[model samples]
Target: MEIRDLTPAERRVWRAFPRGRRVDFTDRPPGPERTVRAKVLRALLLTQGAADGEVASLRMTAARITGRLDLKYATVEHPVSLHGCHFDEVPFLYGARVRQFNLQGSHLPGLDAATIHVDGVLRVTGCRVTGLARLGGARISGALFCDGAEFGSPGVATALELNHVSVGRDLYGVGLAAHGTVRLNGAEVTGKVNLRDAVLDAPGGTALNAKLLTVGSNVSLDELQAQGEVRLHGARIPGQLGLTGARLSEPGGTALDVGAVVIGSGADLTGLQAEGRIELHDATVTGPLDLSRARLTAPGGVVLDATSLTVGSNVVLHRLQAEGRVELRGATISGQLNCAGARFTNPGETALRASSCTIGELWLREDSLIEGAVNLRRSQIDMVHAEPGAWPDVVKLDGFVYTALNPRRPARERLPLLERDDDGYVPFAYEQLAASYRRIGDEAGVRAVQLARQRRHRGTLPWYARIWGYLQEVTVGYGFKPLRAAAWLVALLAAGTAAFGLHHPPPLKPDETPGFNALFYTLDLLLPIIDFGQEKAFKPQGGYQWLSYALILAGWVLATTIITGITRALSRQ
Candidate 1:
């Protein structure tokens, strides 16, 4: 760049500029002031011709321009550059058309540039606006840069609003500070919306509301400090939505509400420290949603409400220390949901409710402590890699299905998670266990799990029903043990014959007892519908009567158990 110093003739134009008869400002004796009204300046700019080349360094400072500065509903062909200037009142450029606008290091009470169309970059770097800066519905052909500007008036609702504005290139406000709300709702930016190292404070409500905003590249709020909520609902971000070291604190309210937003890449909140609820409900991310080492705290409420969120890749929540509930109910993650060393501290309220979620792989190992219920009902997962003591006590496993549960523990240790109380011993729970065992190719183990579930279910019944359950299980293994049923019948027959042969008691009436064909006589006593006429003929005097009664009881037990077991197998098929 070549040096283009201000010429002597241009200095004369600056020294001879007239102060207007305005009420907001009065010059010091009007000796050498650069005060001009909008009309006269517009006329002078029109006659510039070739003199515009000499005035490229047309910079002014501490000169207050008089009048309303109304450029609203007008069209000017020339580009304007104002530096270090002071506006007597709020400048109104709403609905105006200008080639380019460069206003840097200026102090203004306000700016109304709503619906204005700028042909090139609109740079307002290092300026301070003490009131509302309304640029809503504005259209800029190039970028808008406000690198170190300060905006907002104290006790106001919104300070900077760009609602429905469209920018052709990037919008940079890297070091901007706003004391009230900064509304970018429905705004469309072709490039990134960079707000890195910004400080926004709106204690009454939302500090930054960018609902329905569209950004082509990353929306950088990294290291942003906000006292109120930051709402980015329904915004479409094609790149990373970076919030790496942001501190958002709204106490008992929402701190970051980005629900229904779609990200082409991912949301990087690697070290986010939020005090209130951070909702990402129904959002979709194509890349990994990183929350590693995040510290989110909302005492009894939800710390992170990401319910129904869909992530194309992994959800990395390792080492997260969330104080309240972290819900992922109905969410779908194509990759794993990792919680290796995370600690959740909301008891009685579900700390991590991932019910009905379809996750590729789940890792809750390495002492990840969730103090409340983990509702995984109807969720379909590839595998759950967990340690022995990693499961919470009140786990809601009703219809929670997984292909394989790689609990790296002994069977005795892992089985307790399957059959614990507070919702225990359902048939689906047995099915889940059987499926897990089958994934490991353990058919015997699968049958053992099914049998264990039946036993625990039997324990839940009344004493009479429990007796029937025990008889069915021990005698025939509830239709799952046919060999055991055959063995039991053989043992009973052998014992009955031996008892009859050993104690050859005579009949109560003289010569009334049947002849001792022990095999045929034992069959008559033990068979349910046999007609050997032993019970009719035998009137035993001593211990034979008691032995006959015991054999008949055993016969009924075995016969009923076998029939019931057969019915169960057929019904299952």
Candidate 2:
């Protein structure tokens, strides 16, 4: 480490280290003058300097460092600042403790700082690394900044690894470009982790793996373009997780997997364009989950699998466009689930499967388009804000319950929605619709829905039962329209009175017979329970006798039908 033995560039760097001055050789051409041995730099870092009471640091610019800068298990007091430097080999800093480490705008083969401890900030901003930037198990007291940095080669398996690493402050990787996967699994960051505008290219592999990562503050990945899956499975973020304007594509695979992830604030994916499935099963978002204007495309497959997802606040999916099925089975949303203007198209399959979901309010606007079947069986929604035109052609509404509906349409309009249920003859669906109408004080709507329910139920009965059902429906609308029964009674009574008046019957016993009044005689024949002396004494012959028999039979049939219909109606209430 003698001054006389130092090369020209090494001598300049050594002289500047004691005073923490920067040696700029960027103006020099690529030769020995601009080159320094990594051994010389290591020796200077580990050597004892004169006690000048000055804050010394190794600051060099545009220097080509040769050999491996091995500092394993070593404690370096001075800060290292090497800007725009080119390293021939990766630095070995395993278990090394340093005050601060910065290699801004440097081009290096790689970095090996596993389990290294940095008292101050660890920055590699704008650096281009051709190999893995391994910082696994490293502990940084300050922020870890990698803004505008490029990591790994095109065919590398892993570009950057920060597994189990602990950072005191934020980890910034804004505008970062990685050719392979960037892993932060099991890493804990006290502050926010921002990777906004990052471009991750790892086709058919995980672009960013942050499984089990714990971030104290928000995690922002806005405008990130990831060619592979960006998984945050089981990650716990106390603050918001923002992925606005992100474009993720793993075609036919998972584009973004946040399954079982817990976010404290919320998740904003407002304009995300994903070509593969986005799995969010069992994820819990404390605040709103906004995916407005997002386009998810995984044709004929599941575009979004959010089964068992729990959102504390509103799930805003307005204007969302999904090509495949969006599954929300078993999901629970504490606030409104707004799907206004959303379009879900998975032809010949279930477009949206939201069975067993418990939502506060479900908003389905008229502009929404759902091409395939929608299964909402067993879902409990507090309110349904939907237009009649918003419903798809096929829906499974068995066990689906809603408190109220918007626009307050009559049952004639809303009844079609129940009819659209692929599971035919769903009495529960019809009853639920009737209950909704009743809650709104729409008595007429209730009657209409009940009448429709009876007609639908009749289709499922046996031949004999169906005939009875059809009779009840035609006569009294299954007791829903009692006025029809009264009309039939009046018409039958009038017809019998006129017929008997035209042909008078002879009396069998003149001594006990009353006067033959046509109205009383007709009433006696029609009313089987009533006793009139005229019907008991009179003996009608030929067609008149047959007319009397027909009236008695009709009377019995009408009485039975009326009684049965009234009993059935009472039981339902």
Candidate 3:
């Protein structure tokens, strides 16, 4: 519809066009130039259909529509505009585009597509897509945009990509790929990212890497079976990451490595039957990380390694049931690490190595065993073992026992008991004594002997051998009240010597010619006190030994009382 010339009225309208969609003023041609302008506008505003229509590309300086541009079911041949215009609802633009398109300021109610295709890049930079961006069956070659755009409902854009574009809301896909990176750096999605049954193919390192992306709430990829890897390495999620039914089977090292990431609330990997390794290293979870009902069968040695992690509460690994090895080294748990109902059948060396980790409690109940070395050296455990071990060090009892289960046979059986010649405190003596006393019905004896055994020294000599310890402290001289009996005996010996001298003194006529007079000598010695016989009675034989015993007894008692008084005062301090 080329214009050879234009009428007077047509020229008037053409020279005075506004900056928006042009509404129909009248049906009659306003003559030459104006009529040509109307024809150009109509070509620009028509939608795409199967009518096979094409028109001359308009070369006007700048085109604008004064009203809403209805492009439903009509194709445009040249670049058009509805910039800064208002759309009451979605004006369908399926399979219709100019060489370069721009709708920087407009409002689209919704987008419906059925195998619709867009060739050139479509730019709707600041456009607000009010309804769901339904591109489930559409093919887009160029980058698409709704970035910085708001969505009122959930958007489903499966098998599509805006390679260098961004998403402003939660994008749902079954199998999506981006030759270039799909940037959703600051998008806020209110719903889950249902990527189950989706393939993300970013060949450089990840099929899809949304590092530093932000998910508003939950991100559910359950059974979202991916062929390539899914790397959300540093994405920030405010809620649970639901991968309960996902199958991450990529062989490029790790299929799903969200390591060094942070889930503000927590995450769930339950029933996530993945073949590749799942690494969540250095990740911080503010709530419980639930990996229950998960089946992780990695080919490498370590299946799920979440080392150096800080979980706010418990890490519910109940029924995790992994076949490969799991390395949880240096992970700190504020609550319990419940592996009850789980089975780590790693038929090789060590099954589960979680050494040097701190946990509030550890539960390996319901017929569980390490089947290999289980080391928890220097790891602080509050409580452990709700059930007895079926094997030796297979299950560690590193924490306080609340309820005593049947004594672990392997630990008890390996311990050495006390021998008769052994000089150390005997092991298992408490239980052994209790058993013996119970058999004899000597309850009192058992209790009394138990207390005595605890207080008695085992490797020392008997008290009788050190009796000098008691004897040396006594006051041993005369005038002591404890040795008063010794003083009485000494006085009686002196009196007896005086009486013998006076009553039966040695005969004064004794051997008259040669011997001296014994009676005269006794009288001379005891003249001032009493008469004494010629005997050794006044001299008194060595009879002071009895006094020594009294002094020893007196000294021992005084020493004992002083020691007791000092001990009592020191105890108070």
Candidate 4:
């Protein structure tokens, strides 16, 4: 359009475009004087105007732009800055290439910048859009700023879509308020994606869907308040994915889903408050996963499901409060799994299910509270640092193996933990406890645990087998206390000697009999294998004969039990 056809606002913008001067119409009233035709603005951006030595840009503020800024498939050389401007319709810039696109504080119905390429930053800071802001498949050489921007109203399907978009620098959405889903699925950001203090409300639907998103640096969602599910499933972040102080609520459903994601620097979810389940299944984190002081509540369901999650470093869950089950089953942690001051509460079910987990060290300190059971079945942990009080009423330790135990308490204190296994009489649990004691050279603890194991095994045996087990325990303490066998032998010998000494027996044959001494006679009768010929030579009649018979039977009983107990003990060693 010519200068004669341009409105007063457009005339000012037209005259200022060559010199890159900003036309401020904030003082103008709402009339034709403050209105600029979109075609005039687009014409100035597309045409080359000669200037002295200044860069040409279409910069205008507080102007009402009428008609669509149709720049589809067009390449504009100059930059565009329309701050605090109001658009009559959505600007159609599909597949267009521009230097820099700045619409900061602009009020638009929506934006259609799909497949567009911007050489410099795209600033939409503090803008309000009542419809969808579609920027899918766009490529920005610089950062994409959307700080304090409001997108769509309530009940919208999608407020802002950046699917498959690529940003060379950071994507800032600090304090951004989106009423529907803000999708960044398959987007690639060379720098960080900062959505700190942002509020996303899409009740009963997804709030942020960033599946398969790849970020070169950190993705900060700290202090973000999301009403629906925030899915980052399959997203790959080279730096930390921080959600500290974030509040996510999606009751009876998933609040945060980061399944199968690969995080290079790990995740920081400290001080997070999530009402529904937070899934991290099959995720891999290179650095530490710090969830300290996070509160996750999903009663009767899983609050945090991190099954098969692999962390290169520590998983710090200190002071974490979880109302439902926290599943770490099949997880592999290279460093310590610290639950120092965490509280897990799931009344009738497993509060923490860590079955099949491979952990370097598991720290369950005295301050940790588990109201329900803890299932550690089939887990292989290098070391465990747990206080006696940290164990819950029921613990499933069958097939659980640990190389070392901290505080190295006596078996009396530690044995109770093994006994509390929900599956009654698990021999492996007792054996593992004994092995832990043996590694620390606690011989007494080993004996105690072994003896407890035998006792527990006795209860599961048949009635006749239990009887024999009881006899072994009473006489030799299941071979753990060898001195008890000797004591019984000495007591039986004294009684046999006294009974025969008081009543001398008659000889079977006078010529064949040797001189009968009380001690030798008793020894000959009580010892089964060794014979001193006193039993063949002597004939003890009536009550005295019965005394000799009783001595013989007692000897066989003691001899059989001692040999069996010794063999069992040797096999264990």
**Model 4: runs farther than 4 Å from truth?**
none
Q: Whole-model lDDT, candidate 1?
A: 0.81
**Clashing residue pairs for model 1:** none
What TM-score does candidate 2 get on C-alpha atoms? 0.97
Global lDDT for candidate 2? 0.93
Pairs clashing within candidate 2: none
**lDDT tens per residue, model 3, 77-123:** 44444444344445554544334345555555654433344454455
Q: Which stretches of candidate 1 lie over 4 Å from their true place?
A: 1-43, 52-58, 61-68, 408-411, 474-494, 505-541, 559-573
Task: Work out the TM-score per prediction.
Answer: 0.86, 0.97, 0.46, 0.97
Q: Which lDDT value does model 4 have at 32?
A: 93
Residue 517, candidate 1: how far off, in angstroms? 4.6
Better of 1 and 3 by lDDT: 1
C-alpha displacement of 343 in model 2, angstroms?
0.7
- Model 1, position 67, has a per-residue lDDT of 59
Question: Candidate 3 — which residues are off by over 4 angstroms?
Answer: 1-166, 174-192, 199-205, 390-573
lDDT of 1 by residue, 332-405 (tens): 99999999999988988778889889999999875798888777888999888888688887778888888878
The residue-level lDDT of candidate 4 at 476 comes to: 80
The whole-model lDDT of each prediction reads 0.81, 0.93, 0.50, 0.93
